[model samples]
Target: MSIQEKRNSDFFLRPRFSIDLKENPEELLERITTYLKSDACIYRSNVADKHVFIDIPVRKSHFWSPQLHFEIVKVDKNSSTLKGLFGPKPQVWTLFMFVHFVVATLFLGVGVFAYVQYRLGESLVFPIAILVALPLIWLLLYFLGSIGKETGKNQMKELHNLLITIIEQ
Candidate 1:
């Protein structure tokens, strides 16, 4: 958190935050870059222009390790805002989305097949079982994602703290 930090309680998959600071945006970005380069900095980070990417070291990271991506935007000559997102590594996110897509497709396919079987007076046991099961699987995925977020919550906090430190300087 900086002078003012906005917490987005509605975003689930990727928590969002923004901080307002009374400092020049470009100078703030450069200061962040220099701060992240110090020997004492523990997080692995990349600073390019007004954007910063911060992550836990790979050896200490898990599939669900959260990463921070943020940008600085000038609001006035003497003030700027830092907007950030905390999310799963891009690969994990892509895989999660892909799995959800597959589950949805399977649900639709099975529903159509069940309708056809019902029309033909065939037993609804198997298709209905599958249709019932897909939703449960989706729910499981949702819970798993929430669990992952909880698992990485501390690391996300650490990353945010680092940003706050850089911004304060």
Candidate 2:
């Protein structure tokens, strides 16, 4: 019943964790499949090979709903390990990453142009403003991710509890 928390970077919106289990890998997968398929489950789930994905029901979801993804790794013949992650939906993750990439690219491009303007003795106001603003925007993105994680905190706990229950059984 020991679940150890691994502190990945403090800003990581997607949290990764692992649990040691005494059951075999196949048995763990089978248990997740069986539980997800049974009537007692309130969540939606997908099982493929050694991986399992759990989602909140659509009727009770929001723009920041969390998803649980886990993989069972074989640890010798008599035991297995369950590595799990809690994150936003793939599309949302992609969107955030794309925005970050664009912001970074713009920051670089704007910085170069601003430097050129400075060297040319032209107006430095606009590019300097942009340079300052880009970092603020980046910081905003980080805070937004933190806010989103906080928004989905309860669901994260629910998903985690469900995984613990499955693994403990």
Please provide TM-scores, in order, for all candidate models, with all chains considered together: 0.90, 0.92
Error at 166, model 2, angstroms: 1.4
Candidate 1: where are CA atoms >4 Å away?
A: none
Candidate-wise lDDT, in order: 0.89, 0.87
Best by lDDT: 1
Listing every candidate in turn, what is its Cα RMSD in Å to the true structure after a full C-alpha superposition? Answer: 1.9, 1.7
Model 1, span 69-128: residue lDDT tens: 999989999899889999999899999999999999999999999999999999999999
Where is the poorest 10-residue window by lDDT in model 2? 1-10
What is the clash count of model 2? Answer: 0
